[model samples]
Target: MATPYIRMNGAGNDFVVVNALETAFRPTQEQARTLGNKATGPGFDQIIGIEPSDGADAFMRVWNSDGGMVETCGNALRCVGWLLLQSTGRDAVTIDTLGGLTTARRAGPDQVTVDMGRPRLRWDEIPLAEEMQTYGIELQVGPIDDPVVHTPGAVSMGNPHVVFFTDRLDDGFVRGTGSLIEHHPLFPEGVNVGFAHVLAPDRIRLRVWERGAGLTKACGTGACAALVAATRRGLTGRRATVEVDGGELQIDWDQATDHVLMTGPVETEGTGTLSL
Candidate 1:
């Protein structure tokens, strides 16, 4: 039997969602490569699998376009949360992932808010090669004396991320510099690189180079990380509107709960049956 799939995008980060509850489907590395290719398949930054869960409403599994499985994806979770909400018509839904359990609820039409959980700030959590203050790690690009980018804030939103505060979002700079930092010796387990241009105390312009997905339209965790980093640096308040290449995401780092709340929109581009 063919596998049914939903093509969805959260703030322009596209994904191919497979409801494993309805049809059991898991893609191999080769299959993921083919399916993620815009030429060969529906094309996506990541493919999400929604499976049954005993602890939560559903278990979400994520795979990058390169077929590398990841711990979690914030945007993908929002998409899955929307699916569960539609299916069960519940005010809120809890989804379990390799990272942990998170809850999502409706904020407005097509808008979903996800509790991204508290970020891991310890150096070991990010698993840097050596111990150092994650608030600002010593790394640089360009030249030794005059580096283009330096002192990035490191954190983990289920996955490692290094956020650099910048004044601009140059495509070439983001791709070239991000690719360099992603595999830097400091980050033991690869990392997602974020370039953020703070617009105000409550707004920021951002871009991200995902670990396996390269440059994407938007990164949910990257936005959350940026806010956390900015707040730590006193650049922004606890809450802010992060603007990405795709759209805007409202991120709030609740002081009381210490959990990052991400509010964004999810879109259903199309649906199809996959021949697996």
Candidate 2:
């Protein structure tokens, strides 16, 4: 029999979701690669599995386009949240992931909000090769006189990220400099690289180079990282709309709770069965 699955997208970051809780479904690296093949399979940025959880409504297993299982995905979280809300008919849903426990709920018309929890600010938390300033860490690429990219802010939103405050999004910096810094020695664990251009106090234009997935249409965690980094640098206020390649997300870094709240939309393209 074919395996059953649902296809969803948060903004433009798409995913293939499966109900592991009901079917004990698990995709191998080869299987994931096959499914993400755009021309042939059900191409998506990542594959998410919904499994029974001990501490939350469900456990979200995340696999990057490369089929490597990672931790936490904000956009995917919202998609899963909507699923749980529909199935259980609840106002809210808590999801447990390798990164941590997160909760999501309905925000507005066809939109969802997720609490990403406080960020890990220490260099050790980002797990850089050694200790350094999280703000403007001592790392750079290109020539000494004029580096292609330099002085990025670092933070860990479950996983890890390095954000470069650029003047514009339509530049070579995103694709040109992203790959170099993604695997840079500074970040012990690979990282998502973000290029952000603050349009105003309440808005930011951004792009990201995901660690394992390369350039994606949208990156939820990357948006959180950019907002946190912008706040730390006093670029934008605690709340703002982060515009990504795919769409925009409302980000709120609450001072009282010290948690990042991300609100966005999820689109279900529908479901189907695949022989895996």
Q: 156-190 in candidate 2: lDDT tens per residue?
A: 99999999988746646577688888888887778
Question: For each candidate, what TM-score against the reference?
Answer: 0.98, 0.96
Q: Which stretches of candidate 1 lie over 4 Å from their true place?
A: none
Candidate topping lDDT: 1
- For model 2 the local lDDT of residue 24 reads 81
lDDT of each structure? 0.93, 0.89
Clashes per model (N, Cα, C within 3 A): 0, 0
Model 2 — TM-score against the truth? 0.96
Cα displacement (angstroms), candidate 1, residue 269, comes to: 0.8
